[model samples]
Target: MASESLIKTSKYTKYTSYKKISYRSFFVGLLLFIVVSLLFIVVFNAYSGSSPRTDFHEPVNLDSTLLEVVNLKSDARLSSARVSNCTYWDCFNVYRCGRGGHDKITIYIYPLKDYRTESGTPFSQFSKEFYVILDTIRHSKYYTSNPEEACLLVPSIDTLNQHSFSKKHVSQALHSLKYWNDGENHLIFNMLPGSAPNYNSVIDLNTGKAIIAGAGFDTWSFRYGFDISIPVYSHTAEKIDSSQPDQKNYLIISTQLNIPKHYLEVLQNIASSSNDLLLLDKCKMDSDRIDYSKRCEYTTGRMFSYPDVLKEGMFCLVIRSARLTQAVLMDVLASQCIPIVIADSVVMPFNSHVDWNRISLFVPEDNVKNIVKIVHSVSKERRGELYWQLRWVYDKYFASIEKMTLTALEIINEKVFPLAARMYEDWNMPEHIYGPVNPLFLPVTAPKAPGFTAVILTYDRVDSLFTLVKKLVRTSQWHEARGATPAVHPMFTTFIMCDANRS
Candidate 1:
């Protein structure tokens, strides 16, 4: 009986010991859970504090009645009370009249073109007229000074130049204007020559600093300056409808031709031989040599819409003009027509957007005979490829005018305007006085010069030589501009060692 009681006691002791371990484990787990929860709470609070909060409140909208303020005198005081009382919604509130008391930067515009008038004027007149119109637009929007604010400074009709001002006059004006250096005023309008002499004078005065806007002006003069190349926007896509009559093969020749007589004669011969080419000369044709074959002639007097012309043709001839830039080439792309470029030039102005080989056939100007060969070689299958490629180009590059305009505006606002303002502020002031300045010119370190000369082997594409030379020149110039000696990198130089006679 004693032995049995001792065994029962041993079993009870083991059970009690197990119960104690279980209770201790439970308490340890509970403690860990509590610590983790506290850590998570702290992290969550820290994350919430670091995040930014957006303002979601609606702004008050301004009234159209405020537009009338444009006609008021420049010295007229805009009431701070009225502006402060005005409600704005989803708009930039002009706080000039408020407590800020900032000096407003004023931009003046003078538009010469009457937007209401349908009759087109000369390019010079158009520029001047547009300046006035731009000023009016800005003024109507109530651009004015409060204290230190950016505002539009449009002078009344009396303030505009009586006639188109000369370049000298413009330069003198630029030099004399203290307001331009004040960081609170600027001239943002276009200018036109009052007379031919004024235009010449400006050309002479501005020299390397001026840029021509359109084709009528010289582009080379602005090589060292800034130019605003306005692209012509078209809303047309070339559609190939099988239902339409295919009998009319429209040959559209839109080029500014001022080449040698021989060049014109060669083109005339080719057009005369082919009934498919339609020559649309924007200049007076050489009547004595023009081949009056079935080819239709459109003279220079009328304003020809690009879409209408492109729609009538399957193939468009893009001939190089001494005066015309890539403006027309862009138009052709917009119309989705196949451009057959006949130029002895490389480095197309619109290279960023165009794929030369895919959408267009680049023919060297020397190989005039190839024109017929290229035309005949383009089978229906090839045309299909060309069409789809052109469509892709349009979709990728010229798809959104509004987006492009907005992007341009953003650039002007964020980059150009700020830079101009700083320039004005720092005008006539030494760099040391203006705090630290960023390096405007940096040196370019070219790789080591190639031991052997690089040669490009070509059969008949002489026109491509110009492009290659231009690229080389640009690279060299870039290096020189940075005050660096460019050594041709032997490792990077490509050798076009080819046996062209084989294929």
Candidate 2:
């Protein structure tokens, strides 16, 4: 009986030992599973949030050279104050401030030039140009001091009467000013009649000297005096050989009656006669005046809708209107057309780059007879020389429109974020940070996880889907290079979501 009891006790001891071992094993397995799950969660989150290690390929740094060239070309006359206050950034800021629902600026236009008649008829009609200027100002937020109160301040007779003007036709003259300034709630004034001009005149009110000698002087004059002036640059005419071969001729003339009627008449005659002249006009031609079918070959106008017809010509005649100054001349230069300018003021935009006398033919506005003589004198060889000179000017100052636009945007950004600008400058951030990325030039591969899974969602846009897929492929390759097992073994599976009712 004692032996049997011992056997049972031994069995019980073994069973108890077995139970304890099984419980301990189960707890150890649970703890390991929890640890592994937490570790995985951490790694997944880190991979998802972190920026991939970018391989930076060393680029050719051109900032120093570019800065040196800019400094050399820039006018030495720019004052530190002017540089700080009237920068392109400041201009952009002013534009933004003016457009941000502020008080309107009271632009007081005091004409320094005398009227054509005592009737106060303007010497030139620049209403269109003025309107465009005003419209641009209105759209920009930063220019106005108080946009709510901002308005075109015209000379009031009350202020004029205070200037000791004769009261005989005071009311009539005031009424006329009011009529002329009625559009866009703007105002204008002839400042000479009044003894004391109440408003600030853009031109020297004392000397009666018009600051801008053009049709849009009233508006532009004020803008020049108040707002920061962006130098409207253009290349000057360079001297070229007068006997060059393969010369092309372009005749540029305004067809409006506002210009002397004789100028248009002569141009019309030329258009009918000469094969070289290209007429650009906004006017609708009378069907009966010229046979369109017969003259179609010689004539190119808005009606004809020829693409870049002006650029096709080598020599362009810039007929000067009494009111128009260097505007048309600059246009001809921009078109790479050698200009025969019939106006005063040889000093225009980009005078530093171009030799005006060599490349362009400048005749005084009064000398209409010299137009034909100058045109005939320009030989084909000279035209070739001029073309090369013009091309040089264009490439140096104006070739990359995209780059210029980006530069302008940067200036605007500097104005808006002065603090950030200073910080960036201090850090020596690349000037062309937002330029094209050259994938062929990569620096180093960053460390990454072992495996990756890419899931792309797409809709109806096949092009966008295709682009996304291409980008994913590139990204996978980039990851694979960094030692990560690519999620796409054969190819990445793209899941496209499509709804029958909605795209």
- Name the best candidate (by lDDT): 1
lDDT of 1 by residue, 68-89 (tens): 1122222332211101111122
- Write model 2 residue lDDT over 39-146, tens digit each, in one string: 998898778633332112221121222221111111112111111122223222244233323332233332212222244332322333233333333334323333
Residue 360 error, candidate 1, Å: 3.7
lDDT of residue 311 for candidate 1: 49
Stretches > 4 Å off in candidate 1: 1-165, 173-229, 232-262, 280-307, 326-331, 343-359, 375-386, 389-503
Error of 2 at 191 (Å): 22
lDDT of each: 0.41, 0.40
Q: Choose the strongest candidate by TM-score.
A: 1
Worst 10 residues of 2 by lDDT: 67-76
The number of residue pairs in model 1 that clash at the backbone is 32
TM-score of 2: 0.31
**Candidate 1 global TM-score:** 0.38
